[model samples]
Target chain A: MMVYVIKVGGNVIDNPVLLEQFLADFAKVQGKKILIHGGGKIATRIGDKLGITANYVDGRRITDAATIDVVTMVYGGLVNKQIVAKLQAVGCNAIGLTGADANSIPASKRPVKEIDYGFVGDVVAEELNISSVKLLLDAGLTPVFSPLTHDGKGQILNTNADTIASSLAIALSGSYAVRLIYCFEKKGVLRNAADDDSVINLINRDIYQTLLAEGVLTDGILPKLQNAFNAIESGVKEVLIGHADDVRKNTTDAVAGTLIC
Target chain B: MMVYVIKVGGNVIDNPVLLEQFLADFAKVQGKKILIHGGGKIATRIGDKLGITANYVDGRRITDAATIDVVTMVYGGLVNKQIVAKLQAVGCNAIGLTGADANSIPASKRPVKEIDYGFVGDVVAEELNISSVKLLLDAGLTPVFSPLTHDGKGQILNTNADTIASSLAIALSGSYAVRLIYCFEKKGVLRNAADDDSVINLINRDIYQTLLAEGVLTDGILPKLQNAFNAIESGVKEVLIGHADDVRKNTTDAVAGTLIC
Candidate 1:
């Protein structure tokens, strides 16, 4: 049986109505599945409430020690537990985890290159513990992960949700045919930024490069596509990027969103 | 093999040096074990920082909606993960959990009595999911639980740590001989409030009633002793209340604290 690793980000998670609708749809997916979530806006909002200023280099927020505490409270604690409880209410028996839980994902603190990202961690596929996760999955539990990982030395590092989903898909690909789904607001990767209806049905490596050269995919979408292609190259059976609501609607057809092959 | 359910409160947890020593000693215990922690002081501290006034009638803090959010962030999020990460550093493969995780413990919101305590849960042994916890324990994982539970209907309820430990012990008593230990700063139930060395070695049900009648045990110690006796009567193999440091020292003797019979 194939295992689905669904990645949901701030668009759905930050909005309660959308999150509930998305979770209801997510719960309907059959067989083994995992949910990886990101708390972007909530973390920032909480940080602001706590009088902590967010430091963003380029577009990505740099996680400092105090910011790590806020994210751990918001992402790993409040948001994660809230999702788990809601899933439980919907009959999905979900168990929430941080990287520290079961030492499932031991990442290293990002080295201070030109710009130090503070508490950010870069996860390697080989270092991700698939056995314990597999054990939980085999026992019929849906694992919901927060974008928090530990360095195995004691520090809980804030990580990227997309990276976490891709890493897990790649690591678990050996045992199960893994399908990684990146759920966001868009119906799929759109050809035009303004036109929601212009969903790109498929993007191969050649088309991806062509789009990149054409300046169609830049900024945040670039890294997302990069992670998707990385997962595909690493042996994940399929990767989909699409709307949160369309997850269950495309049960008969596997191509609901932008399919990366 | 016997399973130890050790409940630690904020006194030891709030102090960094004491918490480290306690966790190191806790990691050295033989057989299977679980840690249930309380965050009363920390919750209050955070709540105060957030400009929220803590409402307490008698002794227990009334968990209103805002207070619940603070406790969820502090107890279930920050304090719990910190303990899990620290335990990981000590060579203990600790998995942190809220009551909602794996639906391990389902509780109901406490019904309003003469005084209404909002968002607080009352745990029943039958509602506790021992099988899932046993599965995690048998797989060689030490579960560090936060004092938070869910109502199975999507609400996260703030629970008492001592109650959680007692409920877990009673529920798991069918399979494993459970020993419940409550660790705090005090040596034990002190005969004299001001004397550190005036430890009450043991207290049977009769002595407990007599002590209560004589006004020897009052205020905070009343509920603690009550929970201990409740656990003992519910078929827990043994229950001890003592200083955090003495946990590892009295391994052989098991008489380092106040034993409730």
Candidate 2:
């Protein structure tokens, strides 16, 4: 059986109109699937309103104690529950989750280096409780995940949605044929960074090497590509990078994104 | 098999020490169980920080638009996840839930009469998707629910935790010998309103009638007793009204609370 593990970002989550359309399309996709969602500006906005300042270092936001609580409420609570309800309205039996639920994704708090990331957690793919996830999927339920993991010591930690998506993809590969999809603002990995139409339809290792040698891969797409290839090496059948609008297509044979084999 | 559906209210929730002690005892109880928690002062505290007002009518808190969103985040998100994590830490395999999750508890928005309690949901016992809940329990996962349900058409509604507890007890009675326990600040149903130690060990319908005729019940305990008797009438094996500290003992043959049969 094939399972689609889709990751949708803050861009889609922040916009009500886009989120509704995306969820409708997502609900219509056949077979087993999981959704990992990113925490949008809503958390930061809510944090600001609550007098919790967002701390940043090297252009990345820090999950301080207060910030972690804010994210836990906004991302795991408000945003996640709202999405689940809407999906149910559209006939999808969606169940929302955090890593803390059922102890599904046990993660370790990030070690301190030059700067402390506070309550951010790093998940090791091998440690995921795939059996519980498989249990839900096998029982005809869709599990929706928030970008949060726990330290197993009663602490919920902020996690990266992209990382959660790929890690889950890699972990579930053993049980099913997995197509990991990263839904973003753009169509796909562009051959010409300036033109959205110049999407690279396919990228095997050979093409990736050639593209890298030619400096065609932009800095923004570098991490996403590296993450995708890592998923492939870890036994995920395929990976797709596409616009949120093309999620359903990316799940099928007529993929409208960068397909990494 | 016996399934205990336990509900703990805001008094325990607002105090960290009390909550930790309660959860440890709850985790140590020796059978299948489910926990439904109340929205504590934390929601109101957080809502105040976020500039959402707490509206009240006739001394009852109203679930207005902003208040519902705040409760969804605080009750379903922050408090629920934290409890799940802590339970996991104590070796209880807890999975946090709202009524919206997995559509386990379907509800309808309360219709307007004298008051339009915005976004408040009233759950019907038969409408609960007990199979999903049974699956999780059979899989050895303990469910920890927040006082949040959904209108089937995409709205998360604030529900009374006591109602949720009794409703689940009634619904699960067909599958298991159900024990519905409501844990609050008091030791048990009191013989004297002024004395905390005046605990009534047991109450049957005949005893209840005599007590009602004598007006032994206070304004606060009347609703709880009524709810408990309703559960008994609906096939629940027993209902316990006790302090949160006595949860484990209340689950056993050597009970420590007011047992209604």
RMSD of each: 1.5, 1.0
- Residue A33's lDDT within candidate 1 is 94
Docking class of 1: medium
Name every residue pair that clashes in candidate 1.
Answer: none
Instruction: State every prediction's TM-score relative to the real structure.
Output: 0.97, 0.99
Clashes of 1: 0
Error of 2 at A4 (Å): 0.8
> Model 1, residue A245: displacement in angstroms?
1.0
Q: In order of the candidates, what TM-score does chain B achieve? A: 0.95, 0.98
Give the clashing pairs for model 2.
none
Clashes of 2: 0
The reply for model 2, stretches above 4 Å from the true place, is none
What lDDT does each candidate get? Answer: 0.87, 0.93
Off by over 4 Å in 1: A250-252
